[model samples]
Target: MNLNIFRKQNVKTYLGEDIKFSRTLSAFDLIAMGVGAVIGTGIFILPGTVAATTAGPGVSLSFLVAAMICALAGMCYAEFASAIPVAGSAYSYGNIIYGEFTGWLMGWALILEYMLAVATVAAGWSSYFASFIKPFGLSLPKAISGPFDPKNGVYFDLVAVVVVVLIALLLAQGMKSSIKINNFAVILKIAIILIFIFVGLQFIKPSNYKPFLPYHMSGVIKGATTVFFAFLGFDVVSSSAAEVKKPQKNMPLGIIGTLAVAVVLYMGVSIVLTGMVNYTDLNVANPVAFALQYVHQNWVAELLSLGAMVGMATMMLTMIYSSSRLIYAMARDGLLPHHFSKFDKKHNSPQISLFVVTVVIALGSAFFSVNQLTNLVSFGTLFAFTLVSFGILRLRKRTDISNTGFKVPGYPVVPIISGLFCIFMMCQLNKDVFIMAAIWLVIGAIIYLVYGYHHSQLENKNSKAEEA
Candidate 1:
């Protein structure tokens, strides 16, 4: 059991293996993808709520804190991605640096991150979608339009499930196809965000920022912990290393570059938002639109709502795409049943994996509210970041590894700081979320012991089979 659990796969095997992922994404496409994932519901929906209840005008500072943390972990991820350049992101890094058991845990945690991201974002999408269609005389019933959260009185969120399934259907078309749609939606959403900032900036009341830290340090810290979900998707960009063109150069560019763009946008939007309206008054489901309503810009509010829905749609698409690839990668390595790795010959897509991921996300979104889903996603993501950061320390110990890709600047110091920061943020999460994550990990360990341990390809192979 010890031998099976600690079995490691060499870098040479991953590099030389025919991983079946297409290489069509350029550095720019990757940046766009990263931007697509980073700028989602957190910016559009949570800004108001977090501002009113937690940070007040200091939400901008909260954005700064979260960005700093993400940048550190993003750097570590860049190094691992550059060295490994595989589809599984942290799962791949963990397998090569820490061994099979750790890899399985990372993979399992990532499933939580991506799946909850989809659910929470879909629930967000439904809110904006409902608003976007309100003027058209379309009213969705409460029973089926919201999650089964007793706190919110919602029994099920039908629109959320529909959207996830729709995106999964789109994913089945192929990665190139799904990304093209995502790229377009991302460009549109960015434009809408810019419009909001520029227009809202003109009406800024300097007085609204009077007590910027109204809730003080604890509030800002709480805001940062909550809004960290905004930064969740940036690292998922690394999951596309296997599909990226010139990944050695593009992977790091995408990961770090996305964080930079997202941080600036998040800070700018929050500053402008709080300046336009008192942070207390901005805590609505559609805060951006609510702010616009204050200026009586109904047209702009409608467009922003529409843009938000489209933006969230792209986010759902990207997460589903990345998550399916992760599942496919794990399945291919025999850490899961081989059938899940099956690809459609016509589309060259992971049909079974996509189907499985879509079904799970749909069901989760139907039952869980945005807040519940976001908590789980945030904790799981922070935990994954911790391990990924720690893995960089282990990877650096190997002298046989190639020096072809991007390296994390500052080495051990950066990863050490990154890991510590991640663990600190993990501690900030709601205790209940931490408990749920623990339960999820235990389930993953059981699955690994029952199936993954015996089926691991590396376990059945000789160590001399691959060269460095």
Candidate 2:
């Protein structure tokens, strides 16, 4: 087989291919999907944990920091999705501008992200659901309530698996049904967040914010790194470009609009949370509900927990949906088995790929603890975001393609800054995550060299007599 590291995919031809998707998602549905994905455990759970442990009252500033990074990266995504207007999100963008090798690796990293994201959020949902029902004495035993935690000795989280299976079945029905559920879930999540912010606001004590930066700038930055996971779901919107109506216009709208809404919601929650309860006491698993307990709003607290479980459901569904597309896209390119790309004629959904994703997510959620999976999710996303930031620069240098949709305002500066910010936040992550990511990338490399390199559709096309 010939070595072709720099072989680029043709976006126009790829878009023109017979591969069909039910293009039914409007900009609002895309935004709802993005919102559903972004506003999950990160908001309902992480704010209090980060505030108590790292940033204190200044955790709101951490949201601001992460939002800045997301805004820059989101702009780059908007440009790429608009210009390419295909499935596979960053992986597709990288393939068009960088090469097959880079694209393969990006898709591999994305698979890591989406899988871990579903697993982590599912586990989080289980814990919150358990907490919500414990007062009524309907909670499961320790053996089933949580996944395997070496310290706690719990094993096989039953709720997590059940949720993943249900979501998988829903996705198999098609995008239309899954997205309708997502829209409803998004509205519930936003309403719950608003309820928390407004209701908690009346109980805010000014003294709680006396030393807003109690943990200092380093702590704030650390908090920003931890909470960056909250801003991940918007990119999943881009992954659905092929199924979205008017991809060129609505893709940017969904990406940017989702980020704006997420930032405001996160910041508002952080302020109200710290003010309602002392930051030091907000480190529990159900932080929002824990804070609400102080104000004697047990019913609202229960509702918040219910909303969190629902929010995580949307996140899980979107992540699984996006990751399955990555598999389908790569399989269609012959990097994986062709059957993985096979879509149902009636539903236009990749049933086989969705099944594979569901199985992996269920297994991961059953065994891995949320803390163990969160770092992997964060590392993979930051790595993909870095590549996307760099890909924008490479795409702009190309003169062959007709560029359309939203363009990044500052060209090289925006992407350069976005790339640097991604790197900095990545550097702040635990070293173990880097090691794990490196190991995953190495495995992907091995598979590509042993199989994908030889069997790639592009290689086959290059050898065809007509092409010659």
TM-score of each: 0.92, 0.93
Provide the lDDT at 372 for model 2: 62
Model 2 lDDT tens row, 347-459: 88888988998999899889876676578877888888999998888888888666677999998899999999999888888888888899999999898888887777874
How does candidate 2 score on lDDT? 0.86
lDDT of 1 by residue, 1-468 (tens): 255587787776666553577788887788788888788766777778899999999999998998888899999998888888877888888888888899889999999889888888888788778877888999887778887866666689888899999899988988888888888888899999899898999999999998989999888888888787688888889888888888889999989889988988899999999999999898687788889999887788877877778778888888998899889878978989989988787887789999999989998888865574467777778878999998888888888677588888887798999999888888877788878889999999999988988888774443544432
Residue-pair clash count for candidate 1: 0
Error at 205, model 1, angstroms: 2.3
Query: What clash pairs does model 2 have?
Result: none
User: Residue 403 in candidate 2 has what lDDT?
Assistant: 69
Q: Give candidates' CA RMSD values in order.
A: 2.6, 2.5
Q: Which 10 consecutive residues of model 1 have the lowest summed lDDT?
A: 459-468
